[model samples]
Target chain A: MSAQPTVTHKKRVACVLAQFDTAADVIHAAEKVRDAGYQSWDTHTPFPIHGMDKAMGLSDSRVGWIVLGGALTGLSVAFVMMWWMNGVDYPTVVGGKPPFTTPSMVPVLFELTVLFSSFAAVFGMLGLNKLPRHHHPVFESERFRKASDDKFFISVEAEDPKFNADKVRALFEGVHATFVEVLEVLEEEVEA
Target chain B: MAYYAPLAALDEAHLVAPGSTLAEVTEDIASVTERTAPRGWWIVFLGALSLLGIFGGTVGYLFYRGIGVWGNASPTYWAWDITNFVWWVGIGHAGTLISAVLFLFRQKWRTAINRFAEAMTIFAVICALIFPGLHVGRPWVLHWMFPLPNQMAIWPNFKSPLLWDLFAVGTYFTVSTMFWFVGLIPDLATLRDRSTNKWRQRIYGFLALGWRGSNRHWQNYERAYMILAALSTPLVLSVHSVVSFDFATSVIPGWHTTIFPPYFVAGAVFSGFAMVMTLLLITRTVFKLHRVVLMRHLELMNKIMLLTGTLVGYAYAMEFFIAWYSGNEYERYVFVNRAFGPYAWAYWTMVSCNVLSPQVFWFKKLRRNIPLMFVVSILINIGMWFERFVIIVTSLHRDFLPSAWGMFSPTVMDVTTYLGTMGVFFTLFLLFIRWLPAVAISEVKGTMPQADPHFHGHSERSHSEHDAHESAVGGDLVPEGAE
Candidate 1:
């Protein structure tokens, strides 16, 4: 039988950038986005945009799990090291204490666990989030520099399948988003 | 548009007398400009300097004459060296806890005390380095702890807790120093800006690393700070735990207990907090930071002291009970002798200072009262030092068989080393206060109720939806680079 071609389209999240004078504009836009049933939408501001997490329907991150996993890995290594040292490498009976008792192993084990977990938490967070090698595409916009001072902006990704620039600009207009414009992703940049 | 004018009532144009400039209203701040020191301050500084001089001389003498010159001998090999080591290391803990742990917990009040605490960490660690440096017979071969290819071609025993101490202390000092200085950058910039003349400006400006408070600069600074805090929290806890391993992993009857790690950490926090209170009580009075620092911070720290003190007491009881229950005569004897031996007075003082004195803090009135807490903190410090003494000396004095047991006492040199360390600690602390902004101004400003627009009853004022470029991650969403 002839194979049927599967229909799949790339997803895009159209972001309407805004320079709101007051935080209330940001909140109102967030509410409007939520009402429009945009599940993959988010709001951006200079400082923390209060109540925006609820507006966007986002959940807590799994960064804690990454830390916990790293910590456990560290603890296991510590246990193995202790067991090899006291019980195997140079076993010397002192103060009539057992060579391989768990109580004596507790301190080193606990320390290694914390050491590894915290290390993992930090590096893992940075790695998973893909940070520190600092170049970003958003720097292309000249007006974007004003985002630091008095300006507030909202960016919707063009990669979302539903993110039609025209549709988003229209949506932004409906919500009274002044200066709504397309954030073009060049074909070469997209391909790269 | 007057958008840049501060909204605070005190920041208004006419908030002061109509004719008075903003400069004149804050003239009290300006008056400290003269380069003359108060005689009292000079006396204290000179006294600290002289003690520091003696410390240098004592260390030099010990190096030339050997560790045998100190009081460490049979039955008390660790006496003052180990005791002071533990005490100094314990004193270093509060700064990290105040800066990192409190920051993570979102306690904004830590800003007032964090800088001094951090400087305390660095100096206390420097003081701590002296003991172990002199503990081993050949102080010249101290670099043997580092994994270097030397004439003897020997590597340090990683299994040995002493080597672990080398690693732990070195790691701790490096990380803590980095954390402290990274936090000081913005504050250093503030100091640079405030400096009137060329010399101070040049010095502070160089130290400030060209920080300009740009949003991009603050973004990067915060990222680095968050990373450091995350790194240091575990490093601080682990370093002390590893330090406890110097004893816990040993076979010295009383010292060979599993409870030592948590016990040591709790004791470290207890002593560290006490030192903070001591410094803050004096500094707040001297520097007129009373209104800024406030009573809430002191009360919070006292509550912490009470909590840790209780934990320390519980650990002590558990150790005794475990000793008796283990059916080991040597272990049982070690605990019994600590309470009734020749140094029973020291032991009881430890109990009363660490256990009983902190009990007063259970009352909110006592905790909030500065003078009372200051006294309690000093007693707690005395008690904590004695605790380390009891741990190191009593356990070593009567270990294993009776024939090897002997009493030990600190010589005059031993006392001088400790006195010298106090000098070093205070001198560093004074310099830190004079040079750096003692508070994290940006973090503090961020926490002000005014920073939250919602607090000003203008939640609806933010609704001016003007389209602008933004990302979900907020203002500066630096996109991921290609692999």
Candidate 2:
């Protein structure tokens, strides 16, 4: 009889990390990892650890563009409101200046634009990033409590195709990492 | 940078005896024995409460009587009342700016001062709101600023900056309160766990809202805080800008200007920083928090004052330049009047105090000299108030027609209102210091050297350094599941 037909599943992924002595060392390692054709690698640090952005091959944040859009919309809204309300709705000739003028509306318009744009920048970023909802996989480990206080970590998400628990563990060990552990995903308790 | 020091080693309490753990630091903060509240504190609290009572009594009287008792007469329709309003609002700006804008810039030193500064901002705004709210004779009709489907049938004039002020100040107060409460949550939890009395524990527990410091909670907390910080930074800028528009949108020669928004914002921050310095100096001495507050923090605040002061100075020069360059006769007269006219003493007082006094901050010794810095900060506050008085009263006292020219003087109520506001400000501040942890414990804890595993050396060295560069290589080696 022929051998039974075999099936393979390819959805899970794992990340391997090595310990470095400095932020510069981590960046250097990240660059090497990037060059080696890994697309789903990231690094975590206790603090900001400047220049890590370059190591990760990330682009400039789009937050500013979002702010600009918000500001412009805010500016336009302020200008339109002032112009329509004062010039058209309740026109008054104060200090002999023309009612349908730009200068009178400029201050309110400028203030409002800045106001709206900043609001948009903040709320937009939060919504886009899906933040503050408070769900993450890292809480399952007790040692993770130190994430903000001292420890640095690398998380290769499960969506990454290169993930394999045994293979990733071997890679991390080869790099002389101080520790390695498989992240276990538990079934969430049903609310019923 | 080589100058970087880990902040962890400094955590050892010089006040508390050695061999204390992290939990004990919380205990020291919540200690409420007879020894903790010295006799002097009772005297101070009583003094503050008396001033607050005077303030409350004056407001109550003003409400019962008419607004006519104050010195807001013709020609100078806005006298000490508006001047104090502007001054208090200006003083409030720096707290949120320091906490939120500096946070975004990753200025780590802000952790030491942000908590008290934010509290100052809230109290200052409360003082500010009183004057404008009661300025109109009908105090109950203050809600006219809002849109309502009522018998009055009055839709607020959207074009008016006064109406905009309602929205701007209200937004600022709401957002600042939210940001402040969000920050207080974790600290409240710490207080809850440490309280000896059951009532104190229950009250703090409710305020804490059941925070457990779980990873998920921390994650969410951080995200919400960053968003709030981002919100507050811009709100700070906008509130003052809207306030500036109250004058800028007008056609009065000195009041009208395109650059007023940025100019006012800079001046607000300048005065705000000075007021912060004034409060911190006294609070540090009273509470014996010199180590936590540090001379470095004072120096950093002085640097901010210098920077903002320069911007304000530039704004002063720009106002004159715009007047001359625009070739407008009235605008030129307003500029000339502010300098060489009847109120020139007030004008020059504004210049020397706001412009020149801050120059002393350039000297590191002067900046670190607590007593000298305290005096300069108080003088700056005085000068800033006079600056507003000169701007509001001088410009309006003599307008386009000399025939309408007049002088203004404050009645006793005006004087009392100003004093009462200070009383209210100090009362809240004193209560805050007594009841809560003045320093941000979580933020300070976050800056510890041992918190950075890359830190290698004596903990003392790391404790003093605000910025330390440790290797990120070790940071990345944290086990995936662990993080």
Candidate 3:
């Protein structure tokens, strides 16, 4: 599919993967990998493993703060929109009520706040994950597909300063990983 | 062992059947989509499609004949259509309750049913929206329901409860759908991984967002899911309260009341759980998903129905008490008329179905009895529809002036239109079953005893400490469904 051959014809290694049969093994393996000092690495599994974050020495997500920001935006926007439309522009009169009233405005305020918070929650999570990242080298390994099924995996990317194919293999073997493999992909495929 | 249940009871409780592996959970759920369509699915789908056809035809005729074909007349202007709107909206609440409320409460068993309920929520909201959209009298001007710029620069009255209904229902549907889709992403990725061919891979892959299940992704995904759940908890309660506000804000004798919000909220949850129970009983049986959807889950759901149904019964009695206690002749008359006057049959039917039928659930054996629960579930829904009918029509049809008093009855068009919404609901539900994982497979896997990394290491006795630690994390940990 490539129209032009790159300067180097060799496929590039993306990451080194270690597979485990269960969540416990993968989590303990992650702790060992974390202690060994790898930066660009992650555990892959069908579902989130409890305590895995502490095991891997990762921090809490910023999605909460983003959600709070969204909530404030929704709150202010709802108030301003309602105030501008009913209070200032039209001066609408219904059932002898005032054109603008806080009590009357509370329902819309609540709804919009929730609506915006949800938007921020979904999108913030997606953005932080850098998702829709349709191509990655780890997917090239056939055994990696089980990451979403019965298996657990930890991958240390080529970008990690400590990354070494043989060293990663030795580390994974030390942790009793059931399988270990290196992923390689065409250079141009992941260029984007 | 990772669960909080008493160790004595743990021996008997298996959330996902014993010995089922993670792969099997995925296989069990995804197989419903991958396998050939069952004969029952075909029959139900065709029936639903025909109802949709009726819905389209009746709606067309309504447009051509201009809503007059229905038996909506002077005093009963809000009959049938409005009742259908409220009933469908109420049916959707069970989905949010199961997905969001149950999630926040750490109800691990919800994993078996949350996805199914969430899909129903989205579709029920759609069915509910159909009424307001068409009944706006001029569908083209429906944009006026929102704050938008136009040549005639008027805005929807912010003071009106109807406008709030617009906002509340709109926000409810959007958030609920977002919540459902977020939960689906990981499961969709599983389907993507399991795809045997290019088409399935492409379609499921697109929906899956190319999820690789990286821990970095899960950290934020879990947080987002939690936030959505928290946000939805209040939003679900508020949506129905605002729906009740439509009646409560009015000066009409039966409509004006202070107790409407909580009363309506309880009733919404009540009817919603009944709908979920009704549909779930059928879905599990048809799809052979008894392994994931255990009898214990059904019993738990029945218990919820019993709770909410009794709450609704309390609200009904409170309404009568308040009417008599208020010393307001009009209010007292409305209550008496509802019970002993022209629409007494409808009122009594509602009481019998909603209040009496669910009383059977108080018995443990009856609660778990498949046939009996099924019958009760269907009865609760029928009663809920009557509840709205009584509230809206009965209140309107017999207002203060006996001179203006008249009866409201459903014409064929009204019946057909309401039936068509059922078509819309079932058709969407059938398609959802045919394609999506009806169970939240990833969430269910999280609930499995094996999903907890600490499960195998700690003896059963020490697991309670881990369970406490899980709650102490502010429920950030996807709970090991060790219960």
Candidate 4:
């Protein structure tokens, strides 16, 4: 907390970016970045590079727990909704069965459980990833488009206390970065 | 023809074409969307559009003339509409089976086929829902299917299997659509990046939601995908089971059997694969995607069809055994009526197509035969439809009292509306492949050998630098000299 930088509305530095040619290169570069102790950085690739998670020193994802919570919520909602509708609210009998047939309610219960879990899975993933945040300073780099095509990249944010532009460039160069550059935060978009 | 090699034969089989690169995968799939519509695409589009028009016209007229236009009369109340509903819903299962089930099973081959099959599932489900909507006669009051508080104040029966089906199919549709869209996000970003024009960039970019392929995102994305797959596996199985319950819960001898759940599921898998193979074969050729959609993938799907088809055959035989062994006269009568009664022709067609036709896959050569498999695939679809017809119509038409027994003959409207759904299916499917990457591009790339950071192809020893990195990085990756 003590390392928090002073606010400067006119600050121009967005991030330092590095590009690599292969999955292996990206993985090795990610490992170097991890060893260098840059907290705010990510490796980008056309597809998930298999070993990059370990290389980047990431912990297990929290998505499973979020999904579990979602499933439980769904199960609860289904139970209450069915119980109130069938037993408490509008009671009726059909096919020689009593109202609030627990056995028959199983399908809807399972459906809602899965439904809410899936919602949690998708939106939980997006929220965790801070996605649907369409405006990001990283997109300003022309070379970054290749991150979704045939190339791999690493971007260390300027917000990181360890992120000195020249030092980041030197560290990337020490590894096998094919390219390295700094991106500036445009003035009007800083509020976002 | 070179016989399709099993994946165990390391010399021949590869996940993709032998030497395809990452650039090539992106280029191959993305170009399909970017390229101008081919002549064959236009032909199919026009044909499917006309079919869609027929669907629209028929539904409009049906809404005007009411449900009396169809052949739903006394005794045989549920006919082609219900039969098509089950058939189309059955066809929808292969998508989830491929995408969610195979994914959980770690079947790498599903990558090339899952997206294509999943789109098929959505379109098929839409087609299936049309039957029930129109079958109610009065379409305007369809909201009564839900438990809504209105003037009548009658809540839908929670115990009814019909209501259970609404929840099942509805959840199945919503979850799978979300699953499909979630999967599409990364691929959409690729299209956005590759776009040559403003509109393509804007649309694809908006859909992509600014996916930058950050490793932080992929970790969660992968976990979320896994959870969805886990959820969908049971959801897929339960969907067909609940659908079977629509009949299984009934006392209509043939429909009342305990085996209906597993039977319908097996039949769904069988018919769904047939539909997938039918569509995939055309898509593969038209799009020139033989490299990714390999003969090996087709052979694997054939093997699934063989297994499920055998299961369906067993269920058919077991139905008669149960009927006779129970010593219930009505059960025996229904079985006898199915095989030797007036609708015996349909019963035999079901047997020949659903049971006997798939047995040809016992031979490796037949399993790998493209033209033969295509024909069998179409036959199996027809057979599965007849299987539904046999269960619904035969069981209902012949009652305990001979006075109530009446035959079911589909009216022209029934026939046209049934075929019209096909038009709706293909029109949606064609537009899907045209606008979107029909293959899961990123997933395919992930499965390739080179996607692994540690994979150095056959020349692992040549990367001596990797030896140092391995020591430095604590060897958390795959072991040295991995294939």
Give the per-residue lDDT digits (tens) of candidate 4, residues A1-192: 356555445648889999987677788788888989999999898887766677888999999999999999999998998899888888888767789879989999999999999999999999999989788878989999889887889999988988899999999988778799899975543221
List pairs with backbone clashes in candidate 3. B447-B481
DockQ of each: 0.05, 0.05, 0.57, 0.48
**Model 4 alpha-carbon drift over 4 Å, by segment:** A1-11, A189-192, B1-12, B457-483
Q: How far in Å is the alpha carbon of B9 misplaced in model 3?
A: 10
Worst 10 residues of 2 chain B by lDDT: B12-21
Best prediction by DockQ: 3
Q: Between prediction 2 and prediction 4, which has the larger TM-score?
A: 4
lDDT of 2 by residue, B1-483 (tens): 111233334333222222323333444444422126666567878888888888888888898888887988889888898899889999999999988998887677777788888999999999999889878678787766665545754344555678778778876776676677767766775665556578976777677665434322344345556666876777788899888888988899889988988988998998999999988887777766654677778888998888888788888898899999999998898889889988899989888988898999898888888888888898789889888998898889888998988888889989888998999998888888788777665565444443333444333222222224333223343422233
Tens-place lDDT per residue, model 3, A1-192, is: 756543545688889999987676788789889889999999998888877778888998899999999999999999999999999999978898889889999999999999999999999999999888777888898898898888899999999998899999999998768899998877644231
- Show what share of the native A-B interface contacts model 4 retains: 0.75
- Candidate 4 i-RMS (Å)? 5.5
lDDT of 1 by residue, A4-28 (tens): 6555445333344544444435555
Report, for every candidate in turn, its global Cα lDDT versus the true structure. Answer: 0.67, 0.68, 0.88, 0.88
User: Please, what are the lDDT tens digits per residue for candidate 2 over residues A29-107?
Assistant: 5555555555565665433443445555556555566667887897887777666655776566655667667754554
- TM-scores for the candidates: 0.69, 0.71, 0.94, 0.94
Candidate 3 structure quality by residue, lDDT tens digits, B239-332: 9999999999999999999999998989989999899988998898889998899999999999998898898999999999999999999999
Please provide, for model 1 over B350-392, each residue's C-alpha lDDT reduced to its tens digit, 9 standing for 90 to 100. Answer: 9999999999988988888888999999999999999999999
